[model samples]
Target: MVYTMLDKATLLPDLLRRLDKLPQGHALDLRTYKRNRSVLIRRIGADAFDVTEDGFQKERFQVPFSGLKKLLKVLFKREFPRSTKIRLYALGAADGDDLPTGRKVI
Candidate 1:
């Protein structure tokens, strides 16, 4: 699922909680900020890891709870939504006057 920056803020807690429940075998992929983020969990026996982006742009490591918390605190410095700009495009409108989008006001 693609998430806007705002969506990420709301969803992060839930994601973290879910990760807490997963054993050392299950895997998950998480994208945070506008920056590309992905992780793979390979059960090489019985251990967990924190994977990062390629190109040495980011670093991944094995993390305990404290390490995870610290990583989160440091990595979240960038404000994704604030930095990214989105242009909404509409294909057609009934009147053809303006592109229609967003929720209807009731």
Candidate 2:
């Protein structure tokens, strides 16, 4: 799901809700060029996940999936607003296999 600020403003809540149902191992990768950062969220358990960020010293943090809701809210409210450029990519297993690369969502 390549979400822009506009998409986040309008569909963030719904998106998060759906994400909560995703099976373990699902991942969300967020890219921000302006901030020169990339964040990876990988599900480790039903409600547990790990977050990895690129920076001076690549850091990894663990938080419940619920925490992502707050994180997204903060990003939408304070960091990415209006036209701030951002891209989010979602990946998960499909029948024990990775989703096809050529499959288009829309």
Candidate 3:
């Protein structure tokens, strides 16, 4: 398979546009990997998200949600590769006290 480097400058705008359409409580689960390591990003809000190592919930932590342009720039520079395939999921609103199953958005 061929791997292409993702252009953060161009990708950020489209990503932000999509995120804006989601409901307030929706979440996006981003999964990326390279060789033997993987990273997970659970974007829970338009301006906020949580990061974890290899999908381990126990290792998750909240990350400040800046604008999409800035966030993507940072992610591209520091974390994901151009070929990283991010699987986005839209989580439904939880009931009074329960976690919701995420539905695939794309």
lDDT of each: 0.38, 0.58, 0.45
Model 1: CA > 4 A from native: 1-6, 32-36, 39-48, 54-56, 78-106
Candidate 3 colliding pairs: 6-82, 47-65
Minimum summed lDDT over a 10-residue window in model 1 is located at 87-96
What lDDT score goes with residue 51 in model 2?
A: 66
The runs of at least 3 residues in candidate 3 whose Cα sits more than 4 Å from the true structure, single-residue gaps closed, are 1-10, 33-66, 82-84, 94-106
Which lDDT tens digits does candidate 2 get at residues 1-106? 4444325445566657656886787776555535445556677788887766553335667788768777656544543444455556666642223532221344
Residue lDDT tens for model 3, 1-106: 1123334346556556656564555444443433222333444665665544432233445665554456446554554555445444344453323432333223
> Which pairs of residues collide in candidate 1?
none
TM-score of each: 0.46, 0.58, 0.46
Best by TM-score: 2
Candidate 2, residue 48: how far the Cα is off, in Å: 0.2
Candidate achieving higher lDDT, 2 or 3: 2
Query: What is the lDDT for 72 in model 1?
Result: 50
**Once model 3 is optimally superposed onto the true structure by TM-score, how far is the C-alpha of residue 48 displaced, in angstroms?**
6.2
